[model samples]
Target: MGEATDRSGGRDRFLDRLPWLLRWAVVGSACLLIVAAGVYVLARIAALLAPLTIALAATLFLAALLDPVANWLRRHRTPPALAALATLLLLLGLLVGAIVLVWRLTADQFSDLAKQLDQGLTRTRDFLTSALPISPGQLDEWTRRAVSGLRSSAPDPVTGAATVAEAAGALLLVLVLLFFLLKDGRPMWHWVLGRTSDRSRPMATHAGGAGWRTLGAYTRGTVMIAAIDAIGIGIALVILGVPLALPLAVITFLGGFVPIIGATVAGSVAVLVGLAAKGPTTALLVAAAVIAVQQLEGNLLEPLIMKRQVRLHPVVVLVAVTAGTLLGGIAGAFVSVPITAVVYNVLRTISEDRRAGAHAPTGAPADPPSRSGPGDATGVAGS
Candidate 1:
């Protein structure tokens, strides 16, 4: 009986530890599965969406940014659907007008560029004939070879057009998705909560609210900053006499939405155009203007607008941007900051909840005040 009791005690100890072991195993397995699933999904999405992914991401961002406007309209007695439609129409109209203006500007610039190219080619041929080591004929032969090589490597028009059509289809899908998301966002949240167990509903609600707020703040702040950048840079470029300045400004504005790298790319384009049309000195000035505008946007506008939304350290943002670039290129870069913001908010919410839960009462009675057993009247009288 003694031996049996000892064995039973040992078995109970093992059983107590069994749950811990299983828990660790379960957690590890879940983590591995999650990582694998994330990788697979990312790859699939990249392959399937490609270019349209950028537009889709932009749409979600815009939706989140514009959510407040929709809510305000609803508060003012407008239906959610109508509010969403109005916001969408307003945005679309502005975008279309901007695109038309840019298109016209770009067409004119291209015509001018073609004429310049012809003159430049003629001057290059004459210079080579008169002063270069290579004969004009040799130079011409080299140019022909380069052109042939480029033509050989060019994409087939039919295949390229089909690919473009596919991308357009994907873009249409994104628009449809964005519209539904904007219209049914609240209902979807409630539905998600309703589907969860009662025990988790409160946590879900808290987390959802935190996530939405973060996304909304990021979107709104980014848009305001982008607008400021666009206007400032547009004016600067126009003053610099940059060709296609309007189109370049529009591109800069749109690019600003993608954070660090986008602005740099757009600025490079502006500089190149400035160089082509107005000379190197003008290009340098344009580049400086780009830098000045970025500095203002980064230091002043962003901090003011995003202080309440995301307070990520510069290092954290840089790291996120780097990781995003590695993971999904431009789309990754665009989404990284928002994703980081969401993560930060989630962590904060979880920490707060944990602290609250830790401090909550457990319904146990407090221990009686310490005293000598059967305490004397004076409490100290007992010895």
Candidate 2:
């Protein structure tokens, strides 16, 4: 009994001597581990439902972008379902029209782009041979081996066709989900809240509503930024007389969805095209223009537009995009920022609630006491 008492006493002393901050840190670490484990399990489930997950994500993105329009129509006395359907159809029509327009504008330039790329590659090889110690024969052999390797690893037609079919099916599923989400998303969210305890219901609602607004702002702002980038770069390319300017600008617009790397890649394409068709001076000018545009965007456009929507630091955005790409590829990169914003907003809401509760006064009466009590009159008389 004495030994047990001594052990218990020692343990108590050890705990007592621990710093309060250290104790909280330990608790915080455990909470972080639990959160990470939950996320891992969620990711595993998502992998199992890849197509459905993609559809759901795409639907959420579209709904975020179109919810305002639907709400406006609803306020104007349109039926909710009809409003959602109209919004979705209008978005789809615009998307299809944009695709067709880009296609028609670029179809004649495909051959030209290929020819320029081939010429560029040849010139690059010649430059390398002349500048370095490499013989033309050695460079030719390396190029031949690289081409052979690429050809060997390329997918067969059957596999490529199947992949295309899968993509089309996923796209169709996304459209269907988008329509329903825009129409019934509010009711769906309320139904989810209804399942939770009353204490948690308000927190969940606030987080969800705030997250949706953030997402909406992000989508709209990103589109505007991307358009500006494309137009700026496209106009510069045209002034410089770069070949394939239209196609490159369209690519730049699409690439904006992926954040930093997308614009870089698109701009690089413009530079290369210029190099092949318009020589070194034109290539240098195009590269300069691309850099200037990106610099302006990073410094001015994103800060102003995305400030209210996404409060993420540039480093956080880059890390999120990188991790998403590694884990989920292109689609992951595309949604990474929005997902991060939602998670951040949810955590912020929970933290704020906790802080407010902590600061609330204890032992407060539910209501003010009546002024007609005998004790109140006696106290007043004594004073």
Candidate 3:
């Protein structure tokens, strides 16, 4: 009994010495448990929700791209639903046409492409044999092993079929979500703001508006940059008499959505095609052209467009891309930068507002409400 009393007294003394420690300890433990539970739930839902998440992301991107056009139609006396439907139909038609074109091109040239690939491999092997200290036998052995490994590592037929089905479902989901978002996005946003506390409602509105504008600007600017890249590279490949110029150009265009790595992969294919059809000299020239175009894009186009539009640092973009790829593969990489830009802008705006509020005189009148006007350009309007 005496020892139990002494221990209780000691515990009280410790608590007195660090009066807030127990309270903080309890709070921290609760937070940790909550976080752990959340993470577990997320992990469980990850695979099931992956396609849905991708669809949602695609919908957001499409919404950003088409919202302005829909709004324009609305201003011209078109009903919102009609405007959205029309936009969706037009985009769908274009997408179908593009797919048909690609399919036709591929079907017509597949045999030739196969031959070119064989010849390209042969040429590459020969060049490596002569330039490097590697023997032809060793190279052949390595190639055989790599091929065998790939075959062994590939998913089974059932798994592949399931993946295809999932992708199709996701695409359909995106289309459905995009139509609604384009038609009712503004109302939906206002509704969300309505749910916030009165003091925070303005901040939420400002943040959402700023984020939407950033996303829109990023999408538009990226499309422009990608189009320029495709046109320039396609023209270059055609002038160089490279085989599969159109296909390669289409690839570059699609790849431009993925930023640094995407362009490089597409350009490498162009160089390989050039080498396969026209030999080393032509291949070298094609490579040089690709490099030059990419450099111009990185230094001129991105700096002039994305820098002003997104205001993201290069390092931040790189890290975001890397993290996104690790988390969600190619789709993640494609959307990562734009999402980062939106989040960055939202956070910055909120931070600035908080600072302004803190610095304002206690009795001063609040700033006037922001208005939409001609000067209210998409991304820059919030600032």
lDDT of model 3 at position 63: 78
Q: Which candidate achieves the best lDDT against the true structure?
A: 3
The C-alpha TM-scores of every prediction are 0.74, 0.85, 0.83
Best TM-score goes to which candidate?
2
Off by over 4 Å in 1: 1-56, 115-154, 364-383
| lDDT of model number 2 | 0.77
Per-prediction tally of clashes: 0, 0, 0
Provide the lowest-lDDT 10-residue window in model 3.
374-383
Over the stretch 115-182, how does candidate 1's per-residue lDDT look in tens digits?
65465456546655776688867888998999999999988999899978977786777666666766
Comparing candidate 1 with candidate 3, which one achieves the higher lDDT? 3
- For TM-score, candidate 2 versus 3, the one ahead is 2
Report how far off residue 98 is in candidate 1 (Å). Answer: 1.6
Looking at model 3, the pairs that clash are none
Give candidate 1's whole-model lDDT: 0.72
**Model 2 regions more than 4 Å off:** 1-11, 16-29, 363-383
lDDT of 3 by residue, 1-383 (tens): 99999999999887678759777997899999997698556635753578887787788888788777777777788887888898899889998998898788668667777777778778877888998999999999999999999999999999999999989888888888888877776666666767889998767767776788788788878888888888889889989978778889999998888778789999998998888777788899999999989899888887787647485776887888886787667877887888889888789778767777787789995562463311133422111
Provide the lDDT at 286 for model 1.
92
